[model samples]
Target: MNGPHDMGGMHGMGPIPIEADESVFHSQWEAKVFAMSFATFCNYFPVDETRHASERMPPGDYLTSSYYERWLYALELLITEHNLVTPEEIEQRIAKLSQEEY
Candidate 1:
């Protein structure tokens, strides 16, 4: 259970900056990710499952990823684990979206 995600009492991580009047989400995509995660939580996965999935992410990746990125990783992991979607399908979708952005 000890991982980069479990930095509860660790030190030398730097100070947490407090931003006044910070929005719940810094971007539209973050809000969308939250909405997606929430919906999946209610219907397919429990909150703890998602939390654990996020924790299971590669330590290097977990350390560098943003909060919402971690959530996305969890969602993808759970969905794939349950066979709701395949990894190749997810990769294809990402490729499609990437092409559309051009």
Candidate 2:
């Protein structure tokens, strides 16, 4: 497979940056993404497909996205692809939530 997931030893990629004292999740949503991915995997989705989502992503995005972001991206793709939810439904939900009073 020529996907980004197979790009381990290829050249031209810069060195991995080591963050100093990095927390597990950069934001609350990232933690939620992790949990969502895990829940989906446990229920109906395949873990390999989730991992392969990163590979299937556009090359630039795959290269630039964070680990958890990749997981989140995978979760979104799988949910839509599997007919669990539609993109429009998710967007509407987000819009409704954004307009709600806290």
Candidate 3:
């Protein structure tokens, strides 16, 4: 039942910091996926045509943001759109994790 969208957080993987050029791909599908994932992580709706405007999230905000924060946000959008994970489950999991020590 789990998929890329189901992967709520990067956890121990740390930040997958993507650069502008490195982010772009020759294949349109790859580009779309990257854009979608990035936008989703940033808690922004994905837009196909206007990627520049869509991904124009604040700068320092990104630096301050955790990898898991970005991943969780994106997964939230993807799961909702694809009917993968329920909001109740998301909340429950988050609550459970919050009780644990880092």
Candidate 4:
């Protein structure tokens, strides 16, 4: 069984296998992060009234990337917008991580 902060188990679903290297997050925390990021991204672009209400629309090319990629992009945007992380620091961290093998 997982603790309060463990997100290994599927939400309202059966248990999900936990990989040895994956970082476990609190389900609530993940939900909050997702909501925040999704809302922020939605606000980034103007809505298209012409599009059908039920039809799903994709974000711009940049946001259409993978889930983690979109998260990283949103994080970068938030970091810069809030002045939490400097551009130089982001570049340095990216370079360092790129050199490391998974």
Candidate 5:
């Protein structure tokens, strides 16, 4: 799918920083996202569906978002597309979680 996600063999993107001892996850949420995505893939959606959803993201947003952020977007897209949850439900849940954070 020749999208922005296909960055292979590109030039002038700058060198990838090699960390001496980087952890598998940079933060807790990344691990959570990964787990959530994995669970969904196991039970609900195919892996290719998630990949296509992520590739369907707007080019600017796709390029700017972090890896887990993209995964979250794709998850949301697939779930909403399949009527597992409405966008309103997702927003309501986010609001509930935000309130819990305070």
Candidate 6:
């Protein structure tokens, strides 16, 4: 739906810089996120749904989070909405990995 995420035909935002010969990915994790998102789509998650999920983020988040981070947030939303994983399970796993293991 129409939201702040829709920035098309807007003003105030600066012009986009076109880089000559931009790399497909600026880092390894970007590639991983790209692959993971594609695989998730292959499993039947509609591409439009994914876009809406990502775009529905708060305006601040939508503006500040990087491209892959936005994909991840959208993926999380879809996964939980579709019951692929519970929020608690996701949080538990995040906590486990976030802690020091050494």
The alpha-carbon RMSD values of the candidates against the true structure, listed in the order shown, are: 1.1, 2.0, 14.0, 12.9, 1.2, 2.1
Residue-pair clashes per candidate: 0, 0, 1, 0, 0, 0
Cα RMSD, model 1: 1.1
Candidate 6 C-alpha lDDT tens digits along 22-66: 888888878987898889877969888999889878888888887
The TM-scores of all predictions, comma-separated, are 0.93, 0.85, 0.34, 0.39, 0.90, 0.82
**Candidate 4 on 9-97: residue-level lDDT in tens?**
43774564667876544455466556765575476533332122112223353324444444545556555656767989989977997
Compared with the true structure, what per-residue lDDT tens digits does model 3 show for residues 8-41? 6636647666677653354554555566576654
Q: Model 5: clashing residue pairs?
A: none
Top model number, TM-score: 1
Better model by lDDT, 2 or 3? Answer: 2
Q: What lDDT would each prediction earn against the true structure?
A: 0.93, 0.83, 0.52, 0.50, 0.91, 0.85
- Candidate 1: which pairs clash? none
Query: For residue 73, what is the lDDT in candidate 4?
Result: 56
Q: Which candidate, 5 or 6, would have the higher lDDT against the true structure?
A: 5
Q: Candidate 3 at residue 57, lDDT?
A: 29
Model 3 segments beyond 4 Å from truth?
A: 1-68
TM-score of 5: 0.90
- As for TM-score, the candidate ahead, 1 or 5, is 1
Model 4 residue 81 CA deviation (Å) reads 1.2
Q: Write candidate 1's Cα lDDT for 9-102 as tens digits.
A: 9999999878899889998889999998999989999888888999999999998898999999999999999999999999999999899989
True lDDT of residue 67, candidate 2:
90
In model 4, which regions exceed 4 Å deviation? Answer: 1-60
For candidate 4, the 10 contiguous residues with the lowest summed lDDT are 48-57
lDDT ranking, best first:
1, 5, 6, 2, 3, 4
